[model samples]
Target chain A: MPVTNRQIRLARRPVGPVRQEDWTLTEEPVTGPADGWFLGRTRYLSLDPAMRGWLDDRPSYLPPVGLGEVMRAGSILEVVESAHPDFRVGEFVSGSFGVQEYALSDGRGTRRIDPAAAPLPTHLGALGTPGMTAYFGLLEVGALNEGETVAVSGAAGAVGSLVGQIAKLKGCRVIGIAGGPAKCAWLTEELGFDAAVDYQTEDVRKALRTHAPDGIDVYFDNVGGTVLDAALTRLAVHARVVICGAISQYNNEHTVQGPANYLSLLVRRARMQGFVVFDYVTRYPEAAREIAGWIADGRLSTREHLVKGGVDAFPETFQMLFRGANTGKLILDLT
Target chain B: MPVTNRQIRLARRPVGPVRQEDWTLTEEPVTGPADGWFLGRTRYLSLDPAMRGWLDDRPSYLPPVGLGEVMRAGSILEVVESAHPDFRVGEFVSGSFGVQEYALSDGRGTRRIDPAAAPLPTHLGALGTPGMTAYFGLLEVGALNEGETVAVSGAAGAVGSLVGQIAKLKGCRVIGIAGGPAKCAWLTEELGFDAAVDYQTEDVRKALRTHAPDGIDVYFDNVGGTVLDAALTRLAVHARVVICGAISQYNNEHTVQGPANYLSLLVRRARMQGFVVFDYVTRYPEAAREIAGWIADGRLSTREHLVKGGVDAFPETFQMLFRGANTGKLILDLT
Candidate 1:
């Protein structure tokens, strides 16, 4: 129980953009497990934009990461030693293991992840929280119907890409909205979305009009400022808007711009609902089975944008999500 | 055949409040019918707050009554002569008939109403558009489940009363929001609502918190603006808010007070859906049958605030609704 561990801790709460000074790298000897505890070694870390929200001292789905604590993160780890009979030493597990090289777990809310069925990173992406998010957000909250039209903003990202593809799999005509030509190309040509509207150059409202001539039935909103406004104007009757994450407004120096044309909901008889994926923890297995089936049948695809550097690289790896630096699922390999 | 006919026409558009000057009384002679036309006499003229929306030059569920034309009104009339095969003499027909003593109909969209089941005013209120609206708004749009709590604004009015009673019949705990103590008393004492909040004197938010301690599951919003904001704060998880009417904001000289606490939908993962009851015209009969069954079993109570007046009293009868003058269904008996 004298294993040395290195960790990235929150030096200060970030203002605007996260800086290097916002983090403190420190080392400590990993402590031994108590009666109910199990020891684990970090194998991979899940870099998510929601981590940014967790840093701010405001009300959110989860509490903010305290200063001088190991930065909160979802991680893949191998149980190296165990006093808890349920967790074996060779088993792969996932939980809020934080940005650390090694950790001791009491197995409060840990789940075993199978490395043989899919890659370890898939547990963080297509088979994990982000994947379950896209699944529940689109299908349940969005009330997505087969053959309906779906439009997704930030379409090339981890959740958005899967959202578009899931809509397509549901027999919906899917339109992807992303920043650049590469992302748009990947959304439509590679991911099999019905259309991709490059929001960088094109007028999103006009593009929506062209792609969904009838109107958008489901809008999976990731980038929320003006893009959310644009989608508000094009909602069809009984449309369901999934307010997943507002990435565009996250870095705002001012207050977030809510939609000016919300009256459209009154006219269209539509609905907008927000969802945090963790709320569906009990239903995750149900969604995972459906998603895994799609992945296995060649109806779905999984992509991981991996960045290697272990726990020390947490700061820069976390920044990449906000800058749109990584595509598909952004995972940090501890190896 | 020729007969003297009297009609109320839209003479001018109202600036703030509608007056007698806005309408013109005219007497005309009903001539012989064409091949498809039949003689009809106006038995009951519907005096509704929505008449105000119909007077304005804007698009709504129904088009505006054009200047110099007969003011549009839903009427229960008796077919005195038959030209169309589906039509027969002495049969009461409900249609978008103008405010007139007598007229000829081509019978495009008319429904036969039996006076034996209930009176003509009951047909216009409890078994007509208002009843149909309450049924579909609660059952279809609200997706109201049994044991869920339903809070309705303008709870003493036609649609709101029906909404509360229907929710009760569906095993929902119903709370009514009305303007006065009398209406609130009637809602609770007679209409079978669990509680009624008098918004005229009491703090609505505090009242909602007291009555619905667990939070509101369905908000059938007949009165928008401040009432809606109050209800928004009390929404439970997955709550469905039905945007029926905004009578409180209908006559406002300025813009309606759009809810600022709408982000509660995001916070609770609830939904707000707006629908005009006209959208469910196809299922009006289905709504009528269920509502009638509830009435027959004494599970639902029907109340009409009938203003005894002829066609000359149309403007005043209409004005009463905006002032919240009448409880239950406000109708004009043009007998």
Candidate 2:
């Protein structure tokens, strides 16, 4: 362990697209764990679209990261020292440990993760928050069933990629809407999606008509804005729209453009619900067990784009998420 | 019966606020009932906000009325002749009998309505589509519970007035938002709402803060422009928004302005749903019985604005709904 811990802190609330100036990379002396607490070194950091929401000074599922505080994030950390009874040295754990070299947890939200069960980075992808979000958002919030026609926006990204695979595993006719032909190819060819809409080259509304000839039964919406509006226009009766994240509107300098065609909900007797993964914390183990089984059975696949960098790489790596630069799970390898 | 039946037909689809030119009143020779059909004398016509959506040549739960077709509407009628086995002469029936003096029904959507149970016009208000919309939209879609804080937009209008009352009846704290002082007064004083917000006089956000300090648990949205956006901002965690209608955007010459702060759904883990009352047709009797009982016990009160004129009055009376000119259920008394 180093004598000093490098940390990224929020300098100010971002108005629109995040800039390097919005964050301050600072170094502090590493401290020992207090009673009932444990210290861990962050090995890998999960870069998520939801991180953008936390940068805004607004009321959300979680409070905004306070100015000058360590930027809130989720990561896989290896416990180095512990004064707590439950935690031991060399055990890997996952929690909202923020962007820093050293993380201190009193075991409040921390859970021990195993490297042998799956790769350590996989815990941050399919077996982690992204996986759980896809699980509950589709099966619980979305009420998706077998043979239902599902359309997923941002289908090449972390949560969306997992969502499509899981929906496919559940026997759904999956149509993925993603930018670029390469990402679209991966969704249909590799992920077993029934069809793929290349939102970059094709008209999404017309493509949806061609692909999902029957109206969409479940729409896992990750990208809101025009894509969401187009999906709204093609909902089947009693459609369930899972509002997981709105990556498309997260960096807007102006007001978030809402779906103008939302009245279609009335026409179709449909519902749109938003959910946070933390609410299903108690059931995470159950979902992970099932998802791991699928992975072992060769029915599910997750890809991670690991960028080798120090703490300063956080800003640029996060920007890749909005620009569609990363194909799958975008992670910062801090080690 | 009359030798000539006076009828109002659609001339053209209105681009904005409906004009008289969009309608053409015509006279047709009266004809006797055909086999499996009934001839009825139209008594009361229910004018609704949904009438505007029907004017648009778009796909909805029901098909749009073709140009030159008699304006489609729901009304109470006295069956004068019946070749159908189910419907008998002198029976009061409720169905989608168009805007005409006499109507011929194949007894498809028609149901016998008892005058002894409730007054005839009440059938079009509390026991009608508006009441079913309020009941199911609040309880089922909004998932409202006792002691929950409910904020209803257009609270003095047909569906909204009933929504506020039903929420109160179910032991909720109800806050109503309406355009004028008179309607606001009726919401609080006469309708037994805990509080009222006059959208015309005060800032809606401030009023919502004052009335629903804990935040609105359920928002029964009727008017869907800025009012819907305001309600979206003030929702409590896990709040439910029932989208019954959007009278505010019905006459817009442009696109319907969706709730700009809809991302609040994700922030609060909330839900917004839209439903048409006709979907609950099979359960109508069960809901009507309960609502009627509440009316008899003085737990529910309804006010009707009756306009007496020929079928030519249909266009102006329909416009009154959009103008918020009527306090409660707006009806056309063609008798």
Docking quality (DockQ) for each candidate: 0.27, 0.84
Task: Pick the DockQ winner.
Answer: 2
For candidate 2, give the docking quality class from DockQ: high
True contacts kept of each: 0.35, 0.81
Candidate 2 pairs with clashing backbones: none
lDDT of each: 0.85, 0.91
Candidate 1 reference-contact recovery: 0.35
Q: Which candidate is the best by TM-score?
A: 2
lDDT of 1: 0.85
Residue by residue across B229-260, what tens digits does model 2's lDDT show? 98899999999989988988998888989788
lDDT of candidate 2 over A75-165, digit per residue (tens): 9999999999999999999999999989889999887897887888899999999999999999999998899999999999999999999
For model 1, state the Cα shift of residue A90 in Å.
5.9
